[model samples]
Target: MIEVNFDGIVGPTHNYAGLSIGNRASFANAGAVSSPRLAALQGVGKMRRMLAMGLGQGVFLPHVRPNTDWLRTLGFNGSDTETLASAWMSDRALVANAMSASAMWTANAATVSPAPDTRDGLCHLSVANLSTMPHRASEAGQTERQLRLAFPDPRFFRIHAPLPAAFGDEGAANFMRIAPRSGGPAVEMFVYGEGQSGGFPSRQHRTASEAVARRHGLSPARSLVVRQSDAAIAAGAFHNDVVAVANGHVLFAHEAAFADPAALYAALAALVPDVVTIEVPADRVSLDTAIRTYLFNSQLVTMPDGGMTLVLPGEAQENAAVWAWLNELIAQGGPIDRLEVVDVRESMRNGGGPACLRLRVQVDADALAAIDPRFLLNETVCARLEQVITQEWPESIAPEELGDPRLWDRCARARSALTEALGFGTDEL
Candidate 1:
């Protein structure tokens, strides 16, 4: 068995429009110029690194932003130019929301249940409705198609629709899985920020978490629903992945990550003995500092050698508190033994980190083999993707450029090239 990571490639429409209201980095870098080409390459570079580590890696195609379907839904009519003009004239912010390349963050793509954990003995994936935010809400439809195409065997894989809009599901970004061993029985943890938040909008609703557990056929005994701390959410931890991460038996989290950290650990310990809980107190690394450095968002991966590796963004290395804490953690010789920091500055500026970019799936050899071959990261595929990004992706994009008559053609061409390169259909983007 292996933990296959399906990473979303940053789309050509990548820009900092300050679309995510609570995302601190997004707001801070709102009007800054964005590099879509660099973003895509950075993601591919991470995929390459995962492959180099003898880990399973796959890629999710980007969402085609400036989406005509979304524009149509918003009542824009007539020719492409006419629709673009009308949308921009009516509400520039709506245009920015529709043109968000946020689909690249696959952690929010779906809530997945491995075959071992599901009642039917088949892997179940529920696409997130993302009903809380306009920008993210548009992703459910395309993500469903992508999942179906990737796992075509109905007998082995069941892809379920997103929960109702009222439920406000935000997918795996708020979900975590922990197992005794790589192929052992698992405990599913669903973390939801409360509704009616005082500071940031709580993205994941509690009802939505329960609905997903039911939809996935996960028993109550094997699942735990945890509330995310309002303080963490207030400090720009928009998603639970931003505050806590888990791999195998280890749960690395900030003390303020959950409303009841002790209860979470005790529940997990009840299911699996010797569960390792590495808690970083607020005093040691302030919540503000943690959000700035994305310390918790780093990918905690189990290596082939039985040790864990922290795949972090370059931003982590630049933060003094985060860097010092990492060194100390390794010096103590815990589960995490190595660290691989990669330059994902483009994504970092937009408030996504290494873990935010990938959806982790636990699968056996057969399920892993069934994934689309073209989407797998190998030397040749990685090279081809980088080439397509270099030639077709825009070097820089401004929020205003989303309405440019010329921008659609550029974005379309890039999407087409990527779809072709990745063996996806015309509808993929």
Candidate 2:
């Protein structure tokens, strides 16, 4: 079996409009000019870094943005140009929702269960019905179509439609799995948030978590549902990935991440053997600092060696407390032995870190070989993608420019060129 990290390519329309309610970074950087070219290349560069580290790396192409279909659904009528102008004049918020580029953060793409963990012994994936945020809710249908296109063999992989909007499933960002090894006996952890009266929004509802687990056919004995702290949510941890991350047997989380930390850890210990729980104390790294630096949002990946490595965003290094905690964790390492930091400031400012960019999909060797080869990234593929991004992607994008007719043309050109280069047919995108 092999674990492949599928990283989403940042879209050409990426901008900050203060869209996400509970994301502090998005709010802080609202109305700032964004570099679409830099964002896409930076994400691809991270993919290349993962490949260089001898890890399996795959790429998910960005969906068509400035989605005219969405605008039409919002009751805007006329030619694409007229519709955009009318929508801009009528409701800028609706225009913003239609033009969202949040699909780059594929951590919320879907909830995937490996073949070994599923009831039918076939890998299962449920596209996230991101109903909490209007911008993100539009991604569900396109994401599901893309997943099915990528893995066409239904016998090996099963793709489930998004749950009803009432469930509000946010996908893999709130879900984690710990296996004894790569192949079997995978214990799944589903983390949810209580959407109560609070300063911040709780995106992951408890009922949504339960619905996803049942839809995915996860084993009850090996599955657990834990609650995210109300304090953490109010502190701007919109999703659980902001405060907790797990890989294999290691779980790196903040002290205030969960409502019942002791019970969760004890249950994990009971489910999986030799589970390593690395909890960063609030004193060592305050919740405010953790949310700010995205220290715990780092991806804890099991390296080629038996040990693990932490893939962190550059912001973590800039913060003194988070940086010190990193050093301490490395010094006292058992599972995690190395730290690798990458610059993703473009995505970081929009509240996405290294872990937020990728989805962890485990597939057996044969199933892995069956995957679409065009999506796999190596040195040559990475270079070609970078060249395309540099030439085709716009250097910068402003919020007001989203209504420009030229923007759609340029985005279409870039997306078309990318899909053609990737050998993906029309249905694939």
Candidate 3:
């Protein structure tokens, strides 16, 4: 099966409101001016890079911003503009949550099981509830709608709704799979965090991960659930992806990534006999330095030429320690042969890196065809997206400008234009 990376386009209302409590960069850059146009362009640029490498690339449209419907549920009433104004006056934080573009981090969009690993031999995807944070909790409905539209063929795909809020699910960010190749039986690892006092909250619950594995029909023998290291969480590695990522048989991670690394490794080795474990010890790279540079958040993807490549953020290159380790890794002639760095500084300021920007779906030829063609990317699609972003997206957004009626109108128009350019009807998106 081939792997397709579906990236969420940065929204017209993309800003730094520091909504994610556990994300260190978000808090550090809170209230900073955001350039929506630049953010969208940078996202499209990443897509272009993927396309150039002969990888399958797709786009997830931005969700409608200034979610007036949500505001109405909070007791605000009137036209969309009027409701936004009233809500802003009463509770600015509430309005900020409504306008969030967190959906751009599509890695949190869902937990997916490819056909090769499922009981019925059909791809299964469970949308994440994201119930931990208030701003993110409101994303489930829209996420489901988009998934349903993109994967309409029930014969080849089954898209399940988000789990109940009681079990907090954060999707693929906390999930990993190890296999000899994409089109084969694999070991699915679900990493969760136990709640603790006096630190950032643990978003993914053990019960939630178990439910997803059960719903996906994954075999008990091949499904492994483990706890994320409390130290990693306290160190600002909010998601497991922030500390570890797996592609095919390679598991690249920090030594302190899991609560019990030795046991987890033994279990994984039993499941995949030829599994390659590339561990970066704390002495070589501290967790603090890793999180600061987002070294582990790099996308570990298999290239069309059958070689593995790490798509890292530019910040990784700027750090001396991180860069030294990466260079040494390549020189040692390991499974990871090369590194390709891309600039996503706009998204990086809010703590999302290469791996955070996209969701990886493994599909065979027939299954790939079942997906909506409009969602897939090509040279023409990229060009059209770039044009829409350049002409419609706002150049800059100050924190205080979020409540302005004019800003709301621009965001709405930008999304509408993007949908039209992508051949999607306004009502469909």
Task: Rank by lDDT, highest first.
Answer: 3, 1, 2
Q: 365-388, model 3: which lDDT tens digit per residue? A: 998999999999999999999999
Instruction: Report the candidate with higher TM-score, 1 versus 3.
Output: 3
lDDT of 1 by residue, 1-429 (tens): 678899999999999998887899999999888999999998999999999998988889887767767887889988776777799999888888877899999999999999988899889999999998889998999999888888878867899988889888988989988888544678999999885455679999999999989888998998999999999888899999999999888999999999989888899998977678999988889998889999889999989899999998888898888889889999999889998998888999998999999998887888888876766777888889999999999999986788887887798789899899777667554
Clashing pairs in 3: none
Model 1 RMSD vs true structure: 1.3
Q: Give the clashing residue pairs of candidate 2, or none.
A: none
Compared with the true structure, all predictions reach lDDT values of 0.88, 0.88, 0.94
Clashes (N, CA, C under 3 Å) per candidate? 0, 0, 0
Clashing pairs in 1: none
Residue 175's lDDT in candidate 1: 93
Better of 2 and 3 by lDDT: 3
Error of model 1, residue 364, in angstroms: 0.7
Put down candidate 2 lDDT per residue, 1-429, tens digits, no spaces: 689999999988888888998899999999999998999999999998999899999988888877878889989899877888899999888888887889999999999899888788888888999999999999998898788877778778988898889878899999999887534497898998876526776777788788777877888898899999998998888889999999998888999999999999999888886788889999999999999989877888878886799999999999988999889878975788999999999999999999899988999998898787887888998988898889999999898887788987898788888888778787567
Q: How close is candidate 2 to the true structure, as a TM-score?
A: 0.97
- CA deviation > 4 Å runs, candidate 2: 181-184
